[model samples]
Target: MDPQVTLGERERRTWAAFVTMRRDLEGALARDLARDGLSVSDFEVLARLDQAPGGEMRARDLAAAIGWDKARLSKHVTRMVARGLVERREAAEDGRGQVVVLTTGARQVTAAAVPNHVAAVRRHFFDLIEPDELDVLDRVLTRINARAVEG
Candidate 1:
């Protein structure tokens, strides 16, 4: 690739539209969760934990599951602990490792928020996609995610 080469108009517009749509949709989802006293990040963490066996996971595994690095997961989980949304427990198996556990409050909140979140997702994203475009979008997203993982 040479610096002299530049993205032409269609490429530029496509990139811009993709960026703007992601930003706007993320903001809309954040607002939807905000009404339920959850941030997008918080919901992501709790949602992963909620799905894990026994409503808990090794802290390291939880971090990996949610694609958050340890420090960020640790800091966010600390805040969640303070709010009683989750708790950190010493792992029963290893004793040295930590486990993240979802609280009763988290279960109740997610039970309500999940449906609203789905509706919001459909409203903002899925509803707009033509049925025929779904396959294309899926492949493109898979490639993009693969590239991200590789890099």
Candidate 2:
């Protein structure tokens, strides 16, 4: 084993804490979204589509944005389509590519979900964090994300 590959006591504790915090945070959000009849993945997809120009984005682009593989995205999109949350149509600019568009139902649900989701986030996270701590977190996460992409 490489000497540098070993984690110190502090590093191990930090990693464990990070994993637990993320899992708990995600679980809380999932539960909150479920109360609105949506899954966490559904909220993520709809939120991204709602923010995209024309409230639509190419399927591949959506997958990339969400860090999911095309197959996974396709399956999710299929389910959303069946539930009337989204529609898949040929991309206007690129007929060869498919795009996912938010449906009217999706818009209404997304709009309603946002306020509750924000409240949940604030209650679980923001209310406990100082403004300065948020800034520090942003910087730390940004740097970590950059380093992750480098690999």
Candidate 3:
């Protein structure tokens, strides 16, 4: 580990602004998802599955796609299964492994909720930014993500 270094005033302000914006954005999106009877995590998982081929993926793949650990994914899958939104079945190639499949109910709910989520994102974030500004934001985030992944 390297020695701790304090951020300068400008850096501190930038960090604060980044944190605030991320929190606000996530909170607003979560609220919008809630209105459609889905949590943010649920929508994230369902949306990914909805796009996947055959509307199904392995448990590990689903976890990775959604950036969740095994335990968290297991818990959420359990809940979703109980709600009839998804089902876990033995993997066709490897019976020991499990595959997650989106139920018809999940597909229906996700299809309905996507528009609301997109609208909320636009209203709370994108609509406020100019196209040029969005380009800059995309560049900035790509740079940051690359650095984080490298580290």
Candidate 4:
């Protein structure tokens, strides 16, 4: 193997561990949310909307925040709307654009879900990492997120 072209054995092992840990964490969280009638995607959308200014955000912004494509977000919003979890209103500034507003029901769901979600996060994520390692992880992830946004 070319030394310059290949990952060292330790690097390869570390990457594998990271990937497996991420997948397992996501799977466990998804299962926990499922019990509350939410998938990971649903939780993500709700969480974003809940935090938006005035509990509302542009549909495009919501899509960007959740990393969903326009069409996929449209479908998800439609379903959420039907369930009384969200509502769409024509943008006052731009008639062609739409805003998604979290309904009272949605806020209620998030208020209930957040505590449980945080507990799940604590159990499945934070508890597994030491405090010092968390600082390192945060710095690494923030750098990666910045790069992704720039890209």
Candidate 5:
């Protein structure tokens, strides 16, 4: 957008509301995850790892998958290691690389967390939208995501 081209009233309100709603909703979801002894970020990592082939990924790949920088992923993985949720192993195929592996304990944790987190999503988000609104939301988000990747 051109800096001199001012956002119209509708655009301003929509942006403000969207930002506020996203923050508030994220907070609520995080709180819900706290009860499961996981943060949202923790769950994101664990869930992704759980789905990965062999329940592992190169640390760099995991970071990219979650859209986190290496530093953040390293720090978080360290914490998770302390929690016994994951392990960092030297990749045998490439000695210099590190792989993040999901532990049995974390798989259990993810399994336990999934149902509750899904329920919370339904309760806090899905329940608020009408069935028809879902189609519109999915389409809008898909278009926005496609455009986002283009840049």
Candidate 6:
């Protein structure tokens, strides 16, 4: 291992804490979304579709946006389509490409779930951190994400 690469005691502790926090946060959100008959993945897909232009995005683009592989996205989209949450359409500009479009039902489900999800996030995560801490945390996470993508 590189001499400067090994984690020190503080770094180890910080990494462990961050991992635990993220796991617990995701668990909480998953539970909240499950109560509404949706998984975290489902919520994410719907949310992304809702935000896209015309509430639709090419299947490949959606996969890229969510960092999921094509096969994984296809499976998720298949399930969502069965649940009446979304529909697949042939991309107008690309004969071979398909798009996933959010259904009205999906829009309604997301509209309802988002407020509750936000409240849960505020209660479980944001409320525990001070405003200054939040700012620092955001900056740190942003830099970490940037470095990760660069690497």
Give the winner by TM-score. Answer: 1
lDDT of 2 at 80: 97
How much lDDT does each candidate structure score? 0.93, 0.95, 0.92, 0.91, 0.96, 0.94
Per-candidate clashes come to 0, 0, 0, 0, 0, 0
Local distance difference test, candidate 1: 0.93
TM-score of model number 4: 0.91
Residue range 1-151, candidate 5, lDDT tens digits: 7856988888999999999999999999999999999999999999999899999999999999999999999999999999999999999896988999999999999999999999999999999999999999999999999999899
Predicted candidate 1 versus true structure: per-residue lDDT over 10-48, tens digit per residue: 899999999999999999999999998899999999889
lDDT of 3 at 58: 96
Q: Write down the TM-score of every candidate.
A: 0.95, 0.94, 0.94, 0.91, 0.93, 0.94
Model 3 lDDT at residue 41: 89
lDDT of 4 by residue, 1-151 (tens): 7899998999999999989998999999998888788878889989998878899999998998888899999998899899999999998897988999999988888888888899999999999899889999999999998999998
In model 5, the Cα lDDT at residue 53 comes to 96
lDDT of 6: 0.94
The better-scoring model by TM-score among 4 and 5 is 5
What tens digits encode model 3's per-residue C-alpha lDDT throughout 20-103? 999989998998899999999899889999999989999999999888998999999999999999999999996877999999
Backbone steric clashes in candidate 3, count: 0
Candidate 2 per-residue C-alpha lDDT over 1-151 given as tens digits, one digit per residue, 9 for 90 to 100: 7869999889999999999999999999999999999999999899999999889999999999999999999999999999999999997775898999999999999999999999999999899999889999999999999999999
lDDT string, candidate 6, 41-130, tens digits: 999899899889999999999999999999999999999999999999999995888999999999999999999989988999999999
Predict model 5's lDDT versus the native: 0.96
